[model samples]
Target: MRLVVARCEVTYTGRLSAYLPEAVRLLVFKADGSVLVHADSGGYKPLNWMTPPTVIEDGDGVIVVRKRAGRSEDRLEIRIGELLAEVEHELGEDSGLEKDGVERHLQEALAEQPDALEDGLRLVRREWPTEIGPVDLMCRDADDGWVAVEIKRVATIEAVEQLSRYLEVLRRDPTLEACRGVLAAASVKPQARTLCEARGLGCAEVDLGLLRGAREPELTLFEA
Candidate 1:
């Protein structure tokens, strides 16, 4: 990872146009050719980012990040004013973060009882592979339609977006052209729910306890 603190202005042009006036910010260049511009605020989310499969060129004093997608392209032009600090680090061999506890347990339980997602839903396979990555669970709906299920401990906007991407790829398959997507989580935020509805994706609140074989308390009534 390479981190640079510099005074720069950024402009992005693609489906939309955005400009960041000259200011001091952090520019992060990852090993995968991804670039991120971060303001002092906004927590972890970068102010702007260009993902991998991109090319970054340093020409004279300016930096250009370009990505080509067939005939179209997206570009981020950064005009550097002054470089405050620059540092590079070599972090070798990351095993990646492991998912544990609820999210992991939930996925396992759901895989065993796919119908818990929807009536008559049968598990076609778990971790169904795709070009992007493996989907959490792939199932067949009542009508035998393909359904891609993404399980999250807490369903947020990010989770919805992730499921949307999977749907995009899954639908490209002729056999699964009509594939549907479902976002299942223990709790879903309102914003996430809205996004799911807007995308015509299904959202289900999973019962973690129930799926883990926890039964409700039995009620005993005395004669009255």
Candidate 2:
């Protein structure tokens, strides 16, 4: 990861036009050739970002970031006003993401009892393969419609985005045109819930203890 902080003006030109006036902001250059420009606020989402398969050219005092989509091209140019700081770190190879406790345990329990996520939901298979990656679970609803399940420890916007991608691919198949998506997690952030609802996806909060074979009455007794 390379972090650069500088006072710069950014201009984006492509399908749309955007401009970030001169200011002190953070620029992140990832090992994947992705670049992100971030303001001090706006939570975690960057002000502007260019995904991988991009090229970055750093001149004396200016930087040009460009990406090509299909036959069209998009470009982001950053004109440096002042150089603040720059640092790079050689983070070793990632061993791969480790699922959280809730994610692992909930997925296992849900696989054993698909109805735990939705009534009449029957498991077709776990880790259903796709070009991108394997879905957590693929199932059939009461109507036999395909349901793509993505289990997360804590549902966030990224989780919803991932499920959306899976649904896009699955729905492309004529046999699964009626396929839908469900995001099951221990808890869901408001933003995530809103995005899922807007995308016509279903959201369910799984009961960790119940899925683990704990009696509900015992939970109530413990709560009391």
* Residue 140 displacement in candidate 1 (angstroms): 4.7
The residue-by-residue lDDT of candidate 1 on 76-165, one tens digit each, is 999999999999998886654466688999899999998988999999898898755679999999999989999999999989988986
List candidate 2 segments past 4 Å from native: 68-73, 114-148, 161-181, 210-213, 216-224
Pull out the clashing pairs in model 2.
none
lDDT scores of the candidates, listed in order: 0.89, 0.89
lDDT measured at residue 73 in model 1 versus the true structure, 0 to 100: 86
- What is candidate 1's CA lDDT for residue 111? 96
Angstrom error of the Cα, residue 154, model 2: value is 3.0
lDDT of 1: 0.89
**TM-scores for the candidates:** 0.79, 0.68
Clashes of each: 0, 0
Q: What tens-digit string does per-residue lDDT give for candidate 2 at 1-224?
A: 99999999999998899999999999999887779999999898899988656889999889999987556888999999998999999987765567877789899999999998889999999999875568999999999989999999999999998898687667667898789999999999999999999999999988888787686634334554
Can you give the lDDT of residue 216 in candidate 2? Answer: 67
